[model samples]
Target: MKNVVITGTSRGIGLELVKLFAEEDFNILALSRNAEPVSSIELDNVSAFSFDLGTEVDLKKASDFVENEWNGKVDILIHNAGAFLNKPFQETALEEFRRIYEVNVFGLIGLTQQLMPFMDSSSHIVSISSMGGVQGSMKFAGLSAYSSSKAAIITLTELLAEEYKESGPVFNVLALGAVQTEMLAEAFPGLEAPLSAAEMASYIKNFSLTGSKFYNGKLLQVSNSTP
Candidate 1:
């Protein structure tokens, strides 16, 4: 079975991804702030790590655990953890931006760097972005901070793909549309999403495992309609 490392597995798309991979018997290293939810899954293939992306201690512990458990041979690494804020640009405090950036950008880079040693030539690194991050998308009034972070994700993935071009470990970004999840609900209250978390998770599984072969350093936009 292939080994997969996923962050933000406590709920929503991350949780669904964990369930899908666990059912397929893939060895999964699941990182999340809360462990109880993931522990309830009762799958031997799933190992839940209580991790707060904004915390240095948690990142170090997770890195150590991964080093001991999988060595340096991760088949797939998915950076799915993210933070979202839905305040107007002016009202959004600097602290809010810092908090979101810490999780969505800094934390992501830290974990990816820590795990890079384990990734091989055949490995794939997938970063989850947002449609709002894409230029010309329907920009909402209160998504400035969140959208900017996701935009950063796309650029970072592209840079990594080029950096790793000659060696291996393909990199790609998935710019997803609104999915019916807690985060989406929180971001846009009362707005119904066309896609569900389970459906998104399935697509993510297929992409990470196989479909990523079609492209490298590309931002694939996924949504109910063209964004």
Candidate 2:
């Protein structure tokens, strides 16, 4: 079986991803603040680590611990821990931008950097992005903060994918369309996602485990009904 690591496993897509992967019998190193309550992760195949991604210290420590914690094995790494804030470009606070990018950008990079020491050849790193990253849809009005942050994620993923091309591991960003999750409702209240979180998780596990053939480092949209 494969060993996987996922961030933001407390709820939403992260939680769903953990659930699906666990059901598939993959050993998971799940990270989040409140993961103890998750029954799915209580099994022998799953282990939870509680830590806030905003701090660089936590990233370093968690990565080190997970390396030893998982017996130095990880086949897939998923950077799914993220936050969302919707507001006009003007009203968006610089601190808000910092906070959003802290978890979405710097923090994710920090954690990945530390985790790489443990990952062997032929592993995959999947960063969960958004459709907002690719297009300036009508959704761009109040999503300046959220969209811009995800855009940064895509750019980062691309840059890292290139750096890790010949060596290191496979790095790809999944520009997932709106899925039933708290982050979506925060951006657009009362709007339902075309896909459920479980469906999204199913697709992610399948796509992430594909052959190491290097696809162009770009954002990918996840469609559950068909992938």
Candidate 3:
């Protein structure tokens, strides 16, 4: 079975992705800040652990698990963890802005670096971004820190794909629109999203499995709505 590692598995799209992968019988490492939700499922093919992208110790733990348990082989690595902040740019403190980048950008960089050694050419690295991050896309007020950090990952994905073009492990990013996730609900209360978390997760799962063959260092605008 292919080994997959997913971040932000505690809820929403991340949680749905874990279930989809488990149903497909893939060996999965589900990392989230709260491991209880995933751990309670008790799937033999799934392992749940508390992970913080900003914490070096957590990163080491994930690296060690891949090294010792999966034998240093990861077929898919999904960077889905994100930190959301809905505040006016002027009111957002430096520390708060930095925290957003820490999780959405720096944390992703650190984790990808840590696990890249275990991934081969056949491996796929999918980073989840937002529509707001795309250039000339619809912009939302009070998401300056969040959206800008997401944009960083899109460029980073393209760069990694070029740098490792000969070595393999395809890199791609998905810039998503609004989905009915807790994060979305919290960020924009009372606004109903056109798609559900499970719906989006299914698309992401399918893409992660096959999109690498057709695309690399590319950004797919996976948004049907203008959020």
In candidate 3, what are the lDDT values of residues 59-147, reduced to their tens digit? 98999999999998999999999999999999999999999999999999999999999998999999999999999998889999999
What are the root-mean-square deviations of the candidates from the true structure over C-alphas?
1.3, 2.7, 0.6
Predicted model with the maximum lDDT? 3
Q: Model 3: runs farther than 4 Å from truth?
A: none
State candidate 2's TM-score. Answer: 0.91
Give lDDT per model, in order.
Answer: 0.88, 0.79, 0.96
Which pairs of residues collide in candidate 1?
72-118
lDDT of 1 by residue, 86-190 (tens): 898899999999999999999899988878887767889999999999978888888888889999999999999899988778999999998999998898788
**How much is 29 displaced in model 1, in angstroms?**
0.7
* Residue 37 lDDT in candidate 3: 95
Worst 10 residues of 3 by lDDT: 182-191
State, as a TM-score between 0 and 1, how close model 3 is to the true structure.
0.99
- Top-TM-score candidate index: 3
- Candidate numbers, best TM-score first, in rank order: 3, 1, 2
Alpha-carbon runs more than 4 Å astray in model 1: none
